[model samples]
Target: MQAAISFAISLVAMSFGIAKLPLGPWERGFLALGLIFVVTSSFTLAKCVRDRQEVTEVSSRVDKARLDKLLAEHDPFETKNL
Candidate 1:
């Protein structure tokens, strides 16, 4: 919800600022398109980074759990440490 509101406000501000610029229709359109591309790419990059980190964390957790399970099942007295 907060993000939605912030996005709305920023969009409105950008529109107003762009309207004030003394640019032709093509130029304005290009500017808007560039802004959209930048914003979307930024979001995509951030999400990709976050997803990678999450995958790494999940992988590490799975590995840790597996190791813990193996340790729990092993009998220290009768087992050869390998």
Candidate 2:
């Protein structure tokens, strides 16, 4: 799924062009640079999002384990002596 989405985004960026318009050498270079920047940024942003999600999941698991440990050791109502 991620691969499909990445391909689609890159395809759209590559489709951009001064096709019929008369552009100088420098103008063409800048346009190409802009396209590259957009593609790179999209990939970078996706990675950051994935990294954050993984971190959140790990943190949640750790929290649950801590809670479980505390509950196991807790002695509510102090019913140890009869």
Candidate 3:
């Protein structure tokens, strides 16, 4: 969702550069904002991919059945001896 917004803003600003075919204050501002949006979005995308890879790596090291048993033992409905 954030990536989409950033891309859209960047595209709109770039359109001004292409349509006007002249460099001016507003056009320059738009160009700068567009570049910022692209860079920020790219960084965000890279972070998301990196985090996902880390999670995949960690999950692969765990034993699924043991994990499930631990989850079941911690159930809120389970009675505990005080």
Each candidate's clash count: 0, 0, 0
**Which stretches in model 3 have alpha-carbon errors above 4 Å?**
1-22, 64-82
Report clash pairs, candidate 2.
Answer: none
- lDDT string for model 3 (1-82, tens) is 9978986887677666556766777877777777768778988999999999999877876767677888887878868799
The runs of at least 3 residues in candidate 2 whose Cα sits more than 4 Å from the true structure, single-residue gaps closed, are 2-6, 9-13, 16-21, 80-82
Between candidates 1 and 2, name the one with more favorable lDDT.
1
How many backbone clashes can be found in candidate 3?
A: 0
Q: Rank the candidates by lDDT, best first.
A: 1, 2, 3
Backbone-clash count (model 1): 0
Kindly indicate the candidate among 2 and 3 with the higher lDDT: 2
Order of models, best TM-score first? 1, 2, 3
Candidate 3: pairs in clash: none
Model 1 scores what on Cα lDDT? 0.89
What TM-score, over all chains together, does every model reach? 0.76, 0.69, 0.51
**Worst lDDT window (10 residues) for model 2?**
12-21
Please provide, for model 2 over 2-82, each residue's C-alpha lDDT reduced to its tens digit, 9 standing for 90 to 100: 989989876665655444337887888787787778878988999999999999999999999999999998989777665
| Maximum-TM-score candidate | 1
